[model samples]
Target chain A: MNFILHISKLDKYFDNLHALNDVNFDAKDGRILGLIGQNGAGKSTTFHSILDFIKYNGEITWNGNPINEKTFDEIGYLPEERSLMEKATVQQQIVYFAKLKNRKANWTKPRIKNWMKKFDVKGDLNSKLKSLSKGNQQKIQLICTLIHEPKLIILDEPFSGLDPVNADLLKQSILEAKANGATIIFSSHNMNNVEEICDDLVMLRNGEVVLNGSVQAVRNQFGKNELYVTTPMPKEELRQLPGVETVFVRDNEKYKLKLSNPDAGVELFKLISKGEYIEEFSQQPPSLDEIFREKVGETNE
Target chain B: MVKLMNKFKAIVQETYVNQVKSKSFIILCLLPIIAIALIVIVGLISYQNAASSGNDDTNQIALIADSGIKKSIVQKDGDSIDSSIKTEQQAKHKLKNDDIYGYVKVTKNNDKYTAKYIGNESIDGGVRDDLMQNLSLHQNKLNLSNNNLTSEQIKKLSNKPSFYNYVKSRSNDNKSDDNDIKMGSLQLLIYILYFFLFFYSSITATVISKEKGSKLVEVIFSSTTATKYFIGKITGIVLMMLTQFAIYLIMLFSSYAFLSQADFAKSFIKENSNYVHQIVSNLFNINLLFIIFGLLLGIILSATAGSLVSRREDANKAGQPVFMIVIILFVLSIMFQNNSNSIIPKILSYFPLSSYFFMPIRMINNQANIYEGLISLFILIIFIIGLTYFISKVYKGLMLQNNNEGWFKNLIRGVKYR
Candidate 1:
């Protein structure tokens, strides 16, 4: 059905401060998109603009139609902060959120029970939300987000405050939603989780897109200038190499070196072959963390 | 359109049900019943005390008259009097000793007579009536003997009327009673409506502020438009209030009916039946429609005030000024209640918050015509609609405002920037 959501030239201003600037992104059907940035880096602002929660100078379209109220029915969103009615019962809260997504109670009630079990939540349907622990409350919130089986899901920091076990459970839930052909977009400060789950990523820095592409592609764009090696040579000798710009100990015996030239690996290989005994040497592209820092760091400079 | 409707319905249902089922709501609903029970119990205790005390005063009196009028003080049929011979001091002692219900002291000079009654405190009405009747007879006999008038002449003189009072109309007397009833009933209606308006609006404010405080509003806004969310909340809260009010009215009437079933309360109920009917009928009339619309405006204002603060704890502080404004209007309505025909009250009837109380009171007093009442109502509705529209526009922007500054500063910024 061509369920591609597109956002273009999005600009949002909060008073005199620019919150989002000329942001662009897309989420194709059955793909999970990650939005990663430091605090106040316009990640949340972009989400708000796309959901139409705030007015912005941009266009957001679903299947070539402008986003509207009907467009929201197929979208499930969990805001960055936990939004809940604390005094309400567990069943009541989930039903209310699901109903907002245009699902009937008769259809949602049983599904909620099933989701509750899948999440390993101990409380019954009638238990008040306040009675549950923080982790349990988060699980219940996750259940509310997925109970309606929305075609698109947007979760902002869905794993915050969750223990490792609960976070794993949440990751599985997101994966199941993706398996069901829903487009998923989530923002998180945890790079490992984002790298593990996201097929495409859009990184923001100071209200501008610093990087946007698939995980492998973004890493490849940074090139393979970073090299890791284990050798008998001291750290000072590695620092004195011709094309080496920076050298730091990766560990006691391993050194991570950044090269001034992308093809420095060839020169280093010749040196190792001549006399120096090398235990291990490999040329590798930068990690997502390194690329993120470089992109955001460039903007800072 | 269908999705909007569904979202609206869902919001209303959840809001209404959650609030209605809360413990605070249950307590509020039960308050009127408890109050009515308390009133009945207090009334019954007072009535019982009066009944028991009156039983001790039946057919008891001690007469200590002057010797000269002793013969003239012959007791009438069914009269019981103790004429014990004692000095004035002795009689006072006897009265304190509970030896008699009361003692009457009589002194006669030539053809003039004077009397004073002393008892434990004061004499009963029945005893007073009997004593005065006997004293009058004694005086009349003395006059008859002094003038040497025969019985026939005395009867003939009494038959000739000397003065007459006649009135062309009794409408003034009836109109005063109607005015009293209408004013009393209208005053109560306005007080209750004002209280409900304030209370329900506070509820709305609390709900809004709490949603923001918990950071749930953004997610909610993403699912529905601000207008639908605001209207749904207002509708839900108003419906809850109406349900509460209906329960209170039922409890009030049921308590009345129960109290009236007692033989003692029948007269009290009968005396107030017309006023009760007047209040009930006026409450169901067009005046009630005005009050409802006015209450809607109050809720909208509360929503505006509530949106200023980002935390629930600040809700009361944020809404305090608006709440006080409503209270001031109520006080104004009550202060000028008796002056319904005066210019002050007439002018207040056209005002916004004041009209919720003033116009209804004016209408009840027959000082405001149908046109004025309708116009007052119309103004209130328009004001509310405009405010709601304005609030809806600013609500989304305000919800996104996570300012760390004071609420007033944020409020100013929201108004200017949003």
Candidate 2:
């Protein structure tokens, strides 16, 4: 069962402000799609439209049919602003949310311990949600979202408050869910996490899809214009070189060069290494972080 | 449809279980019972105090008069005078010893009589009044005989006219014997409905606002339709209210059953069986349907108010409109409970909000017929259904909203978005 969530020509208006404008994307099964943008870039709006939490002008369909109540049972969502019933114990909250997704408590109950262990949650099942730290409460919320084994998973800022260790644990769980053929769409401000985990990426800018493709493809579209080299070459000489637009010393012995044309990378690599073995020499397209900044900066201009 | 229903059932179960376990719910449910118990305990203590004080000999008064006058007065007002104290000296001795509450002395003149009541303090007003009336009557008898009036004339002059009261209504051909009891039961029903509407509506509003204020509603809305969720939540709250009412009824019946075995309760029940029957019979009728539908309207409107707020702290303020409405209906109902035939109450009897109070009162007063009650109930049901639908339409937009806009502004936005 390869489930695909296809959102096409989606438009949403909040009074006079256009929140989402003809946004289009697809999240395929067994893959994680990262939605990346700066603040107020319509990433949350896109997720809201997909979940049908707000009215939109276009169609969002699961597989071939329109998303409906039955589809919702197979879908899991975690809102950007993390919240859970503070008065409920961890076990009760998880079971209640799972039940809302149409999963039985008996089935969810036995799996709570395993999920708690997997997420490395610090609190026990009976611990009140409010008693736990913010990170632990988020972990419990994540467990609730995923416990029902939803075919379509949507998470907004799932890693915003997590420490490195907890973030890694969540990353592992997300990958595991992906391996189980879940179509997962998550929005995040952390480019490293997106680069490390996302199979595909979509960048929204002011309610429009500015960039959308597989992670590599989206990056490759910008070409391999960034170069790193560990050389004895001075920064001024590198700046004067053909196709070298800018050069900056990155470390004690390392230099980073930006190429006006990607082909300039081969020449720079040859010149920096002099056909000899170098300690570090690499040329690649800009990172997701740089691309995100470039795209957002372009819109800002 | 099955899946939708399943989700609806899940929401209802969750809402009911969560709220039923809350400290607020438990406290609210027990508050009335505790209050009722306190009242009963206080009443019992007061009654016992009165009974014990009644048994004290010092609470009795003695009268000093001629033997003939004493006999006539004792015959007129028995148990009032302490006949054992026959003379002023003996009464004074008993009073000095704190045995007698007071003493009254009667003196006769040529055409007038004087009675003085003496004690350590002022005599009991009731005893003083009785003594004065007895002395005056004795004087009247003596004067009548001296004036040469016959015994038949005195007897005829002493006789008083008889009087009786009756109430008639269009519903009953005969005069109503239990009008007072029926009116009392109607007032009681109105009060119960008011509490149910006010308390449960506020609860519903708070519950909805709590979810909306947080991000929880987004997650919930994703799993179910807004209509289903709203209906499920209202159903859950209504069921909880019903459960609380059931507990009250059970407590009441259990208390009754337990007390019925006691001699005092048995005699009381036997003495007021007709009143009890009237109260119980008033509870089972088309008025019940109006109460239920009226409660639904209140809960639904409060839910709408709850959905309009962007934060949980605003929930109480959001419920104010509904609270004011309930208060207004209660005041109007009480004001016209007896004057059910008036045009204002008649008009209000058909309106959904006031009908719960007025229709029952009118029916109990026989100012509204069974058909009129049923028609009012039908209108209320239709109003509830329409309101539920309208609120459901706007509920999704309202829940999704997260702004600090004024409630009316938000409501307009919600309608526009819908």
Candidate with the greatest TM-score versus the true structure:
1
- Candidate 2 per-residue lDDT, tens place, B1-418, comes to 7756777898899889987888887887788678757756765676678779877888777888788777877775566667889888899899999888788888877767787788876787776666677777777777887789777987888888878765543233334656667767877788888988888888888888888888789889888899988999999988887787687778777766655665435556566666776787787667667777778888898888888889867867778778888998888877877788989999998987688788888888778789998898888888888888888987898888877788788888887775
In candidate 1, position A61 carries an lDDT of 88
**Cα displacement (Å) at residue B356, model 1:** 1.2
TM-score against truth, every candidate: 0.90, 0.88
Question: What CAPRI-style quality would you assign to candidate 1?
Answer: medium
**lDDT, each prediction:** 0.80, 0.84
Q: What does the lDDT read for residue B169 in candidate 2?
A: 38
Q: Where is model 1 chain B poorest over a 10-residue stretch in terms of lDDT?
A: B71-80
- Candidate 1 fnat reads 0.72
How big is the positional error of residue B338 in model 1, measured in Å on the Cα after superposition? 3.0
Chain A fold similarity by TM-score, each prediction: 0.92, 0.97
Which residue runs of candidate 2 sit more than 4 Å off their true CA positions?
A274-277, B63-86, B104-190, B259-280, B334-342
Worst 10 residues of 2 chain B by lDDT: B166-175
User: How many clashes does the backbone of model 2 have?
Assistant: 0
DockQ of each: 0.71, 0.72
